[model samples]
Target: MSETTHAGNGISTEQAGVEQELVDTVLASFDKAEDPRLMEVMQALTRHLHNFLREVRLTEAEWNTGIDFLTAAGHITDDKRQEFVLLSDVLGASMQTIAMNNQAYKGATEATVFGPFFLEDAPEIPLGGDIAGAAAGQPCWVEGTVTDTSGNPVPGARIEVWEADEDGFYDVQYSDSRIAGRAHLFTAEDGSYAFWGLTPTPYPIPHDGPVGKMLKAVGRSPIRASHLHFMVTAEGLRPLVTHIFVEGDPQIEIGDSVFGVKNSLIKKFETQPVGTPTPDGRDVHSQSWARTRFDIVLAPGSDLR
Candidate 1:
């Protein structure tokens, strides 16, 4: 190879002429990065990426197409929606990540993906109030207690809850003046919380991205199981992000589109007489809902694991 002198950065121009050379040079500069965590992540990323490229003999056109797909995914995002999250849901990455860190909360309500639809600062409803906005689906009365893994009650804990209506749509999916079907409630003195809501339904993820295309290519459905999303937390305790699956929902056993449902999370809800009052004294006569119980046992320490 012919050596050519270059003025900038001291290397011979021939060694620095190619795009790959520039990438390597930029990566090499990270060796002196002060943050250990950042350096570890960057080094692993570089190693895996280089290995992938070499293993697949990746072509420039293929790499460019991947970039374009990701760009298109980002372009489809909006304030109330996240296309990248939908992509993760379809690719099972969301559940995998949740499972990885949630293992320590083993005996607790098993954690699941906090799908993109959760609203921040949800309306603060009272302990037994309904979060469901509209008259949709059969009524369901969900009752649960928040406790530590040691079986001790956790009073004053907060549980943020959200779920889809009967039609498998979130409130954000529509633009009416109706309140969002979500709520934040503080646990009662007995570590208990109860609420009225409609039964959950399987829902489709956004199907207009490369992730959707991948799902189609694999002959898989994009519908997630009917379940409730909960983020429960108490002072001095690790927060819990989890779901309660409706028993008999075939999607739970077969396969959730996001691979989120766990067998231990399934709870059976039984229909009760319309005139019957719930444990919290709410009359069911108006909607004829069923009752289901869920008790969450939080893992201790600062880490939920």
Candidate 2:
């Protein structure tokens, strides 16, 4: 029957198909949807899901199993944790879509997945503050400058940083008392910023649900390369969401969990002697761990101001 006739009534139709049923259900809920963007999202999602079902000829048993997996995923979410984000990480959706959209602002730095561990209010600190705490790991002195494409520094840019501990776990993953590996540093008058944090270590994503099952079925590992996450923004420059992966991270040149790793973003942390002064004016640089520098370039824009 025609779509118009099927609109208001659940008219019995033996010839009804899965796509038709999906359209009717989705359209009914979106009857008041007037935004073009919202309509595009709904239409694309509907088309893709229908196409996927037809391509696989999905069975009822398989669908039920999928539903159970999703249920478990949602059940795992808590006030401080998000299982849905984990699912996206494992499925590579987070990186694929975020990276695709971030490509327009290339030359800033390669953006990566921001696994759900960032806090709403990270303590604001001055540049070169010690962020590594007392955790015993490779000492990495990271210094960088926020600049515009024309090569001028974007002074007073705020930079937020977070990375795994020497043991590959964020401070939040350990105890609330432990806030290591997370720092908020702002650029100096010349747009230069510096800090000390432990070198990030490779770690595994949460593997407990439908996404984990899919990983097993595909014979893929849940490990992600070690890296540092940074969100930098200035008064007039575009905000940059990116990461600096550890040099030689096996997953860097090879298999990244979400294909978000880029060669140019890999940084080598070089060890220093034990008698040199630390970046923060401490006289222990020689005995310190290592150091790496990264300069960020932002495109001209006042959108993030």
Candidate 3:
């Protein structure tokens, strides 16, 4: 191989070796990171990132465009909206992280994306309580039980649930500062829980920002499959974050925007005609509703292995 010199930094100018020396220099710089995990992560990230750049032979203009897009995303992000999380979801990064951290154990429910819409300190509801606090959607009867892999009840497990309204907006997305479509509730001594929530519905991700523009450029749709979010926490079990996707939803065929749909997570949201007897006898005059059962199983301990 003929060695051509590219003056300044003494970087190799050989065809295949052009980027190798720079990669080595960057990896070596992380040797003193003090934290072994950080060092490993940085070195691995550097290698894969460099490999991507080299594989694409990315032009300076394309690189600058990416920077500009991220800058725009940052500017639009605030306490209420997270543009970066949306970006990660569209790129499959969020699901990949969840898969790596949520190890499979006996009968334990799988974990999915912890979307940006989650709010802290959601209101607590009683058994068969309604969480729709004013958001409009068909009433959904959600009942479930929390148990260990051995079928032992996890009494008093706290389940946090949240979902978008029928119009595809979370409570936080509204400028009025209203709170609805989200709440937490604990299980009974028998590990059973129930509440009234909206039936899952398909919705587009926040698409008025930089991530939206990128999706357009890539010919991708921003639609997420219909799903209801759940986060279950018990005293001695691993925290489970997941969603129950609606079965037979046409959107699933197209794929979830966040790549979060799992076959095990899909459940039947059965439609009940008007005048059906309510489980808790909550009145919904002349309104049809839906019902679903999602029994949860949590693995013991918090080890991510």
Candidate 4:
């Protein structure tokens, strides 16, 4: 019998060496990948994955369970919904990748998760126009200035914004073709932009899928902190995707399901009582409103980009 086949009461060194041999064999198959980066990634993935499985001494049943979970996620992902991104978000993989790529530079605004709801065809809003076409929520006035790291104004910067309505549902969640709570607008020559939208409230990520089941299995909450999404781009600046989380959200104190909350991103959404004067002098009738200002700074473009 082969030495590797010998059974023992405890884990044997020979078995460990045999497992490593299998890992090396798998990694060697990636050597012909024309891309050196792909080869490196494959090799590293093999090593880490094998190490984790060995560390946990995963059983055949557990491995099958994992495969089934991934299959379920794949089955649920589609054009409007992304189950894999949700899985990555819940596992902190998305945030880790964001952190590794978006290292601190100057005073550039911090980036966060680009949640699954962003749409490429969001309607355009003129400066100081309204984005809430038909979404239902308390009204909010969002204004911000886009500037470079040096604090110079960045004119013509495109700002994309989206958020869920009062009931914590994004426009894409509707059955009928409804678009609301999302729009894009260009910064003015002075780098200022404003829009009327819904006041953000804490919302649960789509929890009816495989990712949600996994979260429930681990006794974790699927609730994310209340925040509005932003994606900013310009001529010579690194694109910024981030959020301004509403202050005092209970989920922020407990924890954002996606681990996306940053202290710098937290801002107070000041409440305006009924009949208070509105910015831009727009009429809100007898309903109170909310207002917030987010100043965005962009990092310079890099040669590699």
Worst 10 residues of 3 by lDDT: 3-12
How well does candidate 2 match the true structure in TM-score terms?
A: 0.85
Best by lDDT: 3
Candidate 2: clashing pairs of residues: 139-289, 139-290, 273-286, 274-286, 274-287, 275-286, 276-285, 276-286
Candidate 3 regions exceeding 4 Å error are 1-18, 302-304
Write the residue-wise lDDT of candidate 3 on 1-305 in tens digits: 55554443343468546578889999999999999999999999999999898767789999999899989999999999999999888899999999998878887999999898999999998988989999999999999899998999999999999999999999999999999999999999999999999998999999999998888888999999999999999888889999999999999999898999999999999999999988988788889999999999998876848
Clashes of each: 2, 8, 0, 0
Instruction: Please list the residue runs of candidate 4 whose C-alpha ends up more than 4 Å from where it truly belongs after superposition.
Output: 1-9, 303-305
Candidates ranked by lDDT, best first? Answer: 3, 4, 1, 2
User: Which residues of candidate 1, in runs, are more than 4 Å off?
Assistant: 1-27, 273-287
**TM-score of model number 4:** 0.96
Give the range of the ten consecutive residues with the poorest summed lDDT in model 2: 5-14
Error of 2 at 17 (Å): 5.8
Which candidate do you rate higher for TM-score, 1 or 3?
A: 3
Question: lDDT tens digits, residues 110-200, model 1?
Answer: 7788888888877898877888867477777788899998899999999999888888888887877456578889999889988877777
Give candidate 2 misplaced runs (Cα > 4 Å): 1-31, 208-210, 283-288, 302-305
Provide TM-scores for the models.
0.86, 0.85, 0.94, 0.96
Q: What 10-residue stretch in candidate 4 is worst by lDDT?
A: 1-10
Report the C-alpha lDDT of model 2 over 9-97, residue by residue, as the tens digit: 45334334645776678756765789978977887787678768755768999999889888987887876668788778767798887
Best by TM-score: 4
Worst 10 residues of 1 by lDDT: 1-10
* lDDT of predicted model 3: 0.92
